[model samples]
Target chain A: MSEALVDALNPALFWEYRQVLLRGLAFNAYVFFSAATVALIVGLAAALLRVNRAWPFRWIGTLHVEVFRNAPDYIMVIWVHFVLPLLLGKLIGQRVEFSPFASAVIALGFVYSGYFAETFRAGIQSIPQGHLDAGRACGMAESTILWRIILPQVVRRMLPEAVNQFVSLFKATTIVSLIAVPDLMYQVSMVTQQEMRPLPLYTGAAVTYFAVIYVVAGSVRGLSERWRNKIYA
Target chain B: MDAIPAIRVVDLRKNFGALEVLRGVSFDVHRGSVVSMIGASGSGKSTLLRCINRLETPSAGEVFIDGEPMGGPVTANGERKERPLSDINRMRRDLGMVFQQFNLWPHMTVIGNVIEAPLRVRRMKRKAAIALAEECLARVHLSEKGTEYPARLSGGQMQRVAIARALAMQPKAMLFDEPTSSLDPELTDEVLTVMRELAADGTTMIVVTHEMAFARDASDRVLFLHNGQIEEEGPPDQVFGAPKSERCRQFLSKKLQ
Candidate 1:
């Protein structure tokens, strides 16, 4: 609480970084939102593949999730950053440039999708065959069964895990800064470089990350509780 | 009116990896009457009911609903093709089934589970769906507990909700797979009251049961399956009192006592 310690920390400098913070928040939200949107579709599709007894489809989806989930997520982020731009740059030349933002979307969307697919697959299969039979017996088409009957159950049952995945995806955006999208961590790195205050800068990044994740998780919990009451009476 | 058979299952055979479960089972369930299938364990009574709905595909022979043969390969371009899931789903709406386990959607409320099929499957309007759900729930005497989820309900209440759910579909015929086996005696009576009420309303039923007393009292006809085939089938007075086959007689003697 000493004035000297507060002054030394230079909390006032955060005001100067206001625009940069806004930009960082926007980038973070962009990557998380877009990636999560694509990931939800991929996860549900892959989960459907894993559920049925069909061999080839199951294997393709299974292999995709396993190969990506087991390998370090950082590796995919790095690969997308370094390798994709060159390959894309060659194919399209300067006419269609693949920026770090685009790379971040694809990398996060595709990679996290594999993990969430497995999660959704587990969620879907946990529903009994009788439930499905009941749906069919009611004359529901397979598409209706998937969207209306199956996915609602999947989303309601898997809300916490899905929310957890979102938090993880938000954190994963930090890795995209390596490709120079200039996210939150990148901003913190700039402060560290300018002020040579590694601990405080990194500390700020950590606090920011925790705050974002806590807010997200808390919202999910709040929604889940209200939904649970309406469902269970 | 003893017209055309409502359901005709003919020479049904099922084999799973060389183990034959239903061996040449054949039968007829008349319209607007209760047909009780009774047997010891592994006698294929439940399997036969599943075959009628095509839930368990027969390895050989066929099942016919209203004299239309189902559960057999279709001739397509001079080759036989297995029936698609869509075709089977369409065919299944006329029939509804209840499982031994109740099989209610645990995540849904008692009323939500009842109304879900009609709303999601049939695309019934929300207001109409809830009204129909209320009617069905009232039939089963669980009208007040509509908003409660299955997990909060007792086993008997859950089974009644399962019945109400099936009834909400307004099925042409309903199938019961050991409905009373899982419940305590008191709970069993509660479900039977619903079943008896359905019967009085002239809804057709095919029940697979171990409750010999109910079968004797409630069924218009009793089928005694032994070793995957119908050993004896006749009126309850004959099957329960004067069984024809040794298997039927023995099973009745053991089960009835």
Candidate 2:
């Protein structure tokens, strides 16, 4: 048991495959950034729809949020990778296939957008009606008021919640490995199979994820808090 | 031709479901004149003020600003059509409003709030807007605090910033909706002082207020609203000193106490 513990703790195997693992990690970053952008834009749209005066728009926004938020991430990834392409192919009368990376990004982006939508909506609702009234009283158009007055405050108010969602989004990127996107997890599993030693490979993968998430999330939260204080103080 | 009254309301009525908030209320605010509306809590003073700006659409009657009718053209049958949004927005620019809560945008510095309307609505040059904003800030005695955010200001200071923001628009008239009600006594005095200065400057103004002293001292004319109608209206001396209506007299005794 002592020998196995020492072997699992050794990170020599992880060090040996540094080049390939680093490349795989870079892929994870790419997917995270792309998905984060998608999530932010779509999430804001959904939130606006939910708050729209028309019932049809509100219902559509509600349906989108409920369907995506409740769906399991892994199942979503697989469905986007396989089933979605087939459905699209049938509709368009041609073969439609998404790359594993594309599927991973799309699935994760949409799922996270639901959570972001709620956060944005809460931020928007928290604004005093008096603020909107002031904007209108000054003769601002509705769109101008939204962009100038509403969105700026909403962004500040939603930062902490959005940061958490972003962290969760980054962590969720690991799920892409099952769809054969060459993320850090997929590289670790491949190295494990080749080396025929699960202990060090899996342990190394877990540690790497923990270290990256901790450092990155901690820095983002700290920086954002400082910025908020500087402005709000 | 005689100059048009700055604002004229003809039998304005507003109903929230079955509850009638303003029942055939009518009044005129002439140019450079100050009119103060005083009433009990539910007497629809705020509602009437809101209706003047079309923030609350009137269920009946019409408002004419500078002799131009609000809402839209009145058809032969006297039905008012909805005006284009752009037209309403353009008209609203002529009316500067200050609220009780001093609704300054939190994310902006004081100058930013003051300059936003001038820059956006008027489409003024940046330098011109800044110059105008500075002048307005100076008018409110907040020239030194232009860079500070609204959160850092005291209640009195924030209300002054709100006034500066409204003044930047160079509006035809100013509307005060209980502008000092949210402040403490000391802070309230500061805002009322600024208002008195504006009134003395011949700025057209319509004020809805619970401050009987302000209504009595600063107004050219005082209106006493009771149950959604103007129960009494006259010069402040006539209305406050010897009200014709018994209800107006009773209401003043409670507020003044």
Candidate 3:
């Protein structure tokens, strides 16, 4: 709370380096949003596979969720960033390198997709069997029942957990910085090293993350408010 | 009436693992006639209705919808041939089934539930689907509640919305499975009133109910099921007033009291 401490960690110190941090934050946002969207779709697919009548598909889904969920996320990111290109290149007979953004998105998308698969499966199971029977009686095909009757209601039931997944995914973006992705943390480290102002730089980075998380939580709150009264949550 | 039956179940049987729910049940629902099946809780009344639409695939026997064979295994001399899922879905479209729980899609409005089938399965135009939905809602006396979600409705209103959803399909026959069992007496009356109106409109219907009065008054013929078989069946007057079987007599006595 002291003025000197506040002045020492001056806001002016950040102004010159603002562009680097802003760009990094924007990249982080892009990575998080794209990866989270992919994770949601992949997760729904995995959940469906688990609930599929065929045993083979169910085993595939189970294996996917167990493997990705149990593996450490940073290690997976490293594998995607460092090892996959080599494998791909060997297959294609060329030296292939993935841009860090694509690598990060794929890695985090896979990691979070496992969590999302469980969430989605639980939500789907919570829906009464009678609901599906009603759809069947209405003469809806299985795919139609899934899209119209099942998934929408599942989303309603899983909104809170889904928001949590997004937040987790957003935080997970920090791991990409380890792979030379010039995200917010990378920029913060660069600023701190050059200026020797670790306190101000790290605090600014923390504040940026806080702001991103706050926005996500706020948006979810707003969206759920509209549906809370009407939906059978 | 010696016309083609709207729904005909020939020697239908269903088993859940070791539990045989419906055993060699047979019935014909003549067009424009309301047939009510009354029975004890475990007497296979609901199972019989479900078998008609292949909701519960029969272990043996065939169902005919307007003279067309439904999705049971085609048996010739005790040899069975499997039916495709597409065939079952197609056959199911002509059969509208209302459940005891009124399983309307909670995420959609009452009108959305009503219009969904016609729009998706039949690929009806939006304008025409909406009009038909409104008409069906009107028939259920739920025109004003169409835009509201099912979660907002009373038990009776929810069941009415369910009936409207089925009616919107414009099915040849409607199946009711203990449609009022979950409702309180007052709400039960509301649903029964709508069902009575549907029956009067000559909608071919097979209702499974505990309401003896509804079975007697609304239905032309009543089947009393006991131990997974039709213990007695006749004109409601004969079945209710002059039951010949001992099991039917005991069952009716317990229900009436």
Per-candidate clashes, comma-separated: 0, 0, 0
Q: Candidates 1 and 3: which is better by DockQ?
A: 3
Per-residue lDDT for A1-233 in model 2, tens only?
A: 69878877788988999999988889889999999998999999999999999999999999989998999989999999999999999999999999999999899999999999999999999999999999888889999999999999899889999988998898899999999999999998998889988887788778888898899999988988987885677
The whole-model C-alpha lDDT of candidate 2 against the native structure comes to: 0.92
lDDT of each: 0.82, 0.92, 0.90
True contacts kept of 1: 0.57
Candidate maximizing DockQ: 3
* TM-scores for all predictions: 0.92, 0.96, 0.96
Q: Output the TM-score of candidate 1.
A: 0.92
Off by over 4 Å in 3: A1-4, A90-93, B72-80
Q: Which structure is stronger by TM-score: 1 or 3? A: 3
In model 2, what is the error at residue A1, expressed in angstroms?
9.3
Candidate 1 stretches with Cα past 4 Å from truth are A1-6, A88-96, A191-199, A225-233, B72-81
DockQ of 2: 0.72
Task: Give the per-residue lDDT digits (tens) of candidate 3, residues B1-257.
Answer: 85789988888888999999988888899999999999889999998888888788888888999988785554768665667877788889899999999988899989899999999999999999999999999999988997788888999999999999999889999999999999988899999999999999999999999999999999999999988888899999999999999889998998889
Tens-digit lDDT track of model 2 for B1-257: 23789999999999999999999988889999999999999999999998988878899988899988887998899776889878888888999999988999998999999999999999999899999999999988889998998889999999999999999999999999999889998899888889999999999999999999899999999999988899999999999999999999999988888
Candidate 2 ranges with C-alpha deviation above 4 Å? A1-4, A230-233, B75-79
Model 1's C-alpha root-mean-square deviation from the true structure amounts to 2.6
